[model samples]
Target: MPHLTSPAPTTAERIRSACARAGGALLAVEGDDPVAVPVHHLLSDGSFAVAVPLDRVSTASHGMAGSQALLELTDYAPLPVREPVRSLVWVRGVLHSIPPSELTETLDAIATENPNPALLQVETPRSTPTNDDETRYTLLRLDIASVVVTDSTGAEPVPAADLLAARPDPFCDVEATLLWHLTTAHNDIVARLVSRLPASLRRGQVHPLGLDRYGLRFRVEGNDGDHDVRLPFHKPVDDMIALRQAIRVLMGCPFLNGLRARR
Candidate 1:
C-alpha cells in the first residue's frame, strides 16, 4: 500500500495499461481461506491501491501491512476471417503496485458492462424494498506481485494458478442474465441479440427490449413500440430457439395439454 505524492504525466496511459494488463490477473489476499479474486482492476496514481468491496469486508487487514501477489493477464481479439470462431490477442502486459484511483475507475467500467443486472426497483418475497437500499459494490484492489504476458498464438502455458483461485462472484448484470429466463422471454432475446452481434455494433442496454402480455417491444432511449410478431402464413422469427423449445414441449403432449374437448 504505497500512495503517490504527485500526479504522473503518463497517469492516464498507465491507468489504461493497468486495466488492460489485469484482465485475467490472479488476486490473492490473506483471509480465512485465502480469497482469490480477478485482477481486472484499474490503477489511478499510475499504480496499485487498496480496493474497496461493495459487500462486507474483513477490516482486520486494514492496519496490517500489504503483501504482494502474482497475476496473469489475457486479451482476446477475433481472427481476421470469420468462418471459424477464432480470435487473436493483440496486446499483453504485466503490472505491479497499481494505484487506488485506477482501481475505482476499473470497477466502474466492470459495473457498467455488468450483464443482466438486477433492477433496484423490483421487489420480491425475499426482502423488503426501500429507496435507501442500493446495489452492492464488488471491488478488486490490486498490488501487482508479478505479471507475464503472451499472445493466444503462443503455446506456452502461463502459470495463473493463483489467478484462478477464487470464484468470480457474479456481478449485477451477470445475476440478471442467470435469472433472466425464469419467467420471461425478454432476456433470451437480449442475450441472443448481443451474442450474435459483432463488436462494432454490439450494444448492451442501448436499446431496451422486453416482452409484455401481448408480445415483444423495442425502443431507443425514450421512444418504444410494441407489436404482435405472430402472423398468419408468416411468423416473426425473432426468437426461434425459444419458440422451438416450447414447440418440442407442446408436441410431447399432443392433446394440447387439456385444451381439447373430451367426446
Candidate 2:
C-alpha cells in the first residue's frame, strides 16, 4: 500500500471536535476509593462543567479541591461496523464546585455556543438542595491540567490553550447521517471511493467509515484484520454544498464539471 501522509485535523481541533460530539463522560475523582461517576457535561473555559447528582458524590468533598480528577470521552464511528470506536479523549484535571457568583455567567457563555438542554436542567446556585435532590444535580467544574487524545493514528498530548482555541469540525454533526444515507441507500457511491486506495488495500471488503470537512474514510475488512484508510478531498469543505462538489471532484463526476463550466 502507498504510504499516505495523513492530512488530518490538528490535535487541538480533533480534541475539541470530539468533545462537541460527546454527550457524557466518566468523571473519576479522588476518594477512599477512586469514584467513577457517569455524568453528562458541558465544556467551558478549559473545564468539564458537570451537573453532579447530589446523591452521587458528597458535597463536602469540596476540601479535595485541586485534587486529581480524570474525564474520559469516547468518540464512535459515524456508521456501525466491526470496530466502531473512533477515538478516546482522556483529560487530567482538578475537580471543584462552581461558586454561586460565576454559575449564571459561565452557563450563559456556554449557552451561546452550546445551548445543550442539559444546561437548562442545572439549578441556580441559590436554589436549596432538597430531599428530592436525587432528581436534581449540582454544578461543578473540572479544571484541566493535561489532555491526551488517542485515535487510529496514535496517542498524543494536546495543550490546554490549543484545545481552547480550536473549533469543532464543521461537518461533525451531519457526518453520521450523511454516511448512513450513503451506506444504506448509495453503497455503490461509497464503494467507488475505495478505488482511490492502493491496489493492496482494495483486496478487502470496503465500507464507509467516516466523513469530515477534510475528506472521507473507509474501513476495509480484510481476511487478516480491518484496515482504515482516508481519501482527502481536493481541499477542506465547510458546508453541504461545497462538500457535494468536493466529493464529485474526487470521484471525477462529470456533473460537477458541468456546474463549474457555468461559473
Candidate 3:
C-alpha cells in the first residue's frame, strides 16, 4: 500500500501565521499557583508581547512580572467541524514587563512590523489625558525559550531563530473570508471540487475546512464517519491570481467550459 501526504507550511510558518490571526488564546502564568492572565497579544518578528490593562493586572501580578508562562495559540478550521482546532502552537518563555520609559518607543517598533487593533487600548493617547487611570497598561513581553507546533501532520519543535525569520503565509489574513465566500456565494464551485473525492465519500455533507498557500482541505460528514480530503495544487501559490488558477486546475479542468483543451 502507498502512503499519502499533502505538502504543508513549515512549523515556523504555521506558528507565525497562527499568532498573526490569533482568535482563542490562553496565557498561563506559572508559579507556585498558576494564574491565567487575560491578555491582548501581538507578535513582532519573534517577539511575543501582550498588553494587560492595569485594572485587571492585579489578578496575576503576584509573580507575573518575571514568571514562567506558556502561551497557547490555536487556529481553527475556517468552517466549523466536529474538531475545529486546525493548528496549535505552544510558546514557553519568561514574562518581562516593559518599563514605562520605553513603552512609546517599543510600541512604535511593534506597530511598524505588525499593526494590530489589539494595541489600541494601550496606545498613548494623542492628547495628554486628564485621567491617567484610563490609559494605565502594563506592557509585557514573553522572552521565548522554546516553541512547539502541532497539527494534522504531527508535532515539531521550532527554533527561536527560525520563528523569527519565518514569513507568514501570504494568504493568512484573507483565508477565512475567502473560504466562507466560496461556501456561501459559489457553492456550485464547491460541489465541483467535492466531485474529486472517491465515490464512497462523495455522498457526505461537504464543509470547507482549511485553505493554505499550497492546497484546499474539505471535511466530509458521513454516516459512518467524517473524512478529510485535500485537493493539492501542482505548485505552491502565494498570491490571489495564482490561487485562482490553482483552484481552476483542481476543479478537474485547466480551462473554461467553452474553451477547448490545449494541445
Candidate 4:
C-alpha cells in the first residue's frame, strides 16, 4: 500500500468504522496484575459500551466506576493476506459500570445499531440461580480519554475531540462486500486492473485487500513475499453510482499499460 508518511485526519474515522465491524474488542485493565478479556462492544459518541458476563466483570475492573482501562480494536483484511492486520486502535478511557436500571435501554440501543444473537441471551432466563455473579451479565461503559491509531502510516494519538467529530468513509460498511464480489465473481476485471501495476509487480498474483472512499487496496503475492498497493481514484467518490463510475474509468484506461512500463 502507499505509505502514508504521517497519520491522516481520517485515522479517527477509520478507527470508528473498524469498531463497528469488529463485533468485540480486547479490554485491558491497568494495574500490577492486569486483566484482559474479550467483550462484545458498541461504540457511540466517543464512548464504548461493552457486555461482560458477570463472571468476568470484576476481572475487567474492581467493580469501581472511573477506573482506568484500555480497549484495543483491530482491522483485518476480509480476504487472506500475508499481513492480515490492516490497523489497530487503542482507546484509553475511564471505565464505569452501568446500573441495572439502565441495562435494558443500553442493550436496546446496541441492538438497534448492530444486532447479534449473543445479545438475545441477555433476555433469556437462567434455570439455576446461584449467588455466583457468573450467572448474570453486566454492561460497562468506557468514557473516551484518548484514541491512538496505528497503521502503515505509524502510530499517532488522535485528540478525543477529533475522534468524536470524525465520521467514517461513506463506503466503509459496504466496501468489504463489494471487494469480495470483485475478487470472487470478476476475475477478468481484476486482471485488467492488475495490468495497471508496475511491470515488475505484474508477475505477482494480485487480490483485493480493501476499499475506501479514497481508493482501492490490493495484495500482491510474489516470490519474495506479499506486497500491498493502493490504486487511488481520480477523485473521491461518495455514493455507489459514483464509485462504480470511478472503477469503470480505472479499468477502461487505455494508458494503464503504458503507465506500467514507466513504473
Candidate 5:
C-alpha cells in the first residue's frame, strides 16, 4: 500500500460518513480525570448527537449543558482481519444537553437516522425505580469546532467550514453489503482485481475492505503483515449503476496503466 503524503479535501467527508455509519463512538471528556464512554451517536452537518445513559452522564465531565468535550469515532473493516482499523476521526467541540422541551424532537431525529430501539426507550414510562432508567437517557449535542482525521495516510486537520459543507460518500450506508457481495459472490472478479496489486502484495488473501464514490479499498493479509490498497475509479461515480460500471472498468484494466499509483 502506498502512503498518502498530500492531504485530500475529501478526508473530512469520509470522516463524517464513518461517524454516521459507526455503531458508536468513544467519547473522551477533557478534565482532571478524563472519562471515555461508548455511546450511540448521530452525525449531521458539523455536530454530533449521542444518547448517553443518565447513570453514566455525570461521569462525563461535560455531560451537562454548556460544556466542552472530545469524541473519537473509528471505521473498521466489516470482516474480521488482523488489522481492522480503516480510519479514526477526532472531534473537539462544546457539549449542550437537549432541553426537556426539545427531547422529543431530538429523539425523533435520531430514530429517523439510526432507527435504534434504545432511542425509543427515551419516551417510555416505567413503574419501578430501577426500570425508571428509561428517563435517564439524555441526548447531548456536540457543536464541533474542529475535526482531525487519521488513517494509513497520516493525521490531517480539517477546517470546520469544509467539514460542515462536505457530505458523506454516496455509498456510505451500503458499502458493506457491496463489498461482501464482491468478496463472496464474485470470487473470479476478486481474483482479477487482486492481479492489479503489486507483485509483493499479490501473495496475500485479498478482500474488499471499503468502497466510495472515488474508488475501492482492499485488504491484503499475508505472513509479512496486513496492508490496505485503494484503487481509484476512472471518474467519480454518483449512483449504483455508475459504480458498477466503474468496477467493470477497473477489472477490465487490472493494471490500471497510467492511472495515479495506489495510495
Candidate 6:
C-alpha cells in the first residue's frame, strides 16, 4: 500500500506540532543512518542529494527503482535549550524531487529549519563485479515527507484558527496521551516501593497511607507499636541521574528513558 507523506512545515512549527502531537515522532526510513540525521547532500547543480550507503544500497534499490528511495524525515533532535533538553519539531514525508521551481519554498524551509544540516553524497551503483572497487553509489535530490511540529508552549486550550492550522491534528491529542500514560505510571512506582519494604516490617501491620508530596507513606505496626515510614521516590520514572549510572542496564530498553520520570 502507498503511504501518505504530509507536506513540510517549519521546524518551530513542527516541534510545536510534535509537542502537541506528542513528545517525539517515530519515522520509518529504509536507510543506514540515525533517523534524525539528514540525508541531503548538495550538488553542483544546486539540488539536494540522497546517498545510499553501502549497507542499505540493496534495500533502497529493491524498494525504489531507478536510483531513488522514499524517505520519512523527522526532527527528533534534542535541543539543549532548557534544563531537560527541549524536543525539536520533526517532519515526515516521502522525500521525492519536484521541479526546481516547485521546491523553492521547501528548499528555503530546509535551509532555515535544520539545526545541523549535513550533505549525503550518493555514489554511482555499478552492475559489474570488481575486486578492487566493490562499493558503488547513486545520488538523488533530497525531499521530505510529513512535518510534525511541537514545542514546550504547545497548543493553548483556546487556540486561534491560524495557530490551529499549524498543528498536525485538530487538537493537542499527543500531549494528552503522554499525560495519560504518565499518570497511570504512578501505580508502577507504588508497586516497586512497596516491594522494597522489609518483609518483617511488611507482615501484619503495614498499612498504606496513599501517596503525598513526600511519596509513598505507610504505617508499619511492629511488636512495639505503629511507626510511620515514607519512601521518597525522586526518580520513579527515568531518573536522569540514575540513568547515567545504569545506562548500560537500560541500553536494551528503548522506552526506559522516557518512562523513568513516571517511576
My TM-score estimates for the predictions, one after another, are 0.26, 0.86, 0.81, 0.77, 0.78, 0.28
Q: Please write out the lDDT profile of model 3 over residues 1-263, one tens digit for every residue.
A: 10126586778888888877775467777643433333434455466777655555565547477888888887888887887887788889888877767777777776786675555556453524446545455568888888898876678999988987787789888989999899899999898887776676566788888788978888878887677777777678988888988787777674733367668
TM-score of the candidate numbered 3? Answer: 0.81
Q: After superposition, which runs of candidate 6 have C-alpha atoms over 4 Å from their true positions?
A: 1-27, 30-38, 41-52, 65-84, 97-121, 124-145, 155-263
- The collision pairs in model 4 are 1-228
Residue 133 of model 3, lDDT score:
47
| Order of quality (lDDT) | 2, 3, 5, 4, 6, 1
**Which runs in model 5 stand beyond 4 Å of their true positions?**
1-9, 31-45, 58-63, 123-136, 200-203, 222-224, 253-263
The Cα error of candidate 2 at residue 80, in Å, is: 1.1
Instruction: Give the per-residue lDDT digits (tens) of candidate 5, residues 1-263.
Output: 32222232287688768876777677666563434333445455557777666666766554456767778888887866778888888888888876777667766776776787666545333313446424455567888888898887788888777766777788888888888887789988888776766786667877788888888777888788777777777678899888877777777745433365579
Candidate 4: 10-residue stretch with minimal lDDT: 1-10
Over 128-227, each residue of candidate 2 has an lDDT whose tens digit, in order, gives 5555534565667888888999977889998888887888899877778898898789877776677768878777777888788778888888899888
- Candidate 1 or 6, higher TM-score? 6
Model 5 TM-score (2 dp) = 0.78
Give each model's whole-structure lDDT.
Answer: 0.31, 0.75, 0.73, 0.69, 0.71, 0.37
Error of 5 at 118 (Å): 2.7
Looking at model 2, the pairs that clash are none
**Per-residue lDDT over 113-195 for candidate 4, one digit per residue giving the tens place of the 0 to 100 score:** 66765565452233245454343555688898888888765898887677667777787778778888988899787887777
Which tens-of-lDDT digit does each residue in 178-217 have in candidate 6? 3234236555543444556656656545544322111334
Clashes of each: 17, 0, 0, 1, 0, 33
lDDT over C-alpha atoms for residue 149 of model 5: 89
| Model 6, residue 9: C-alpha shift (Å) | 14
For model 4, the local distance difference test gives 0.69
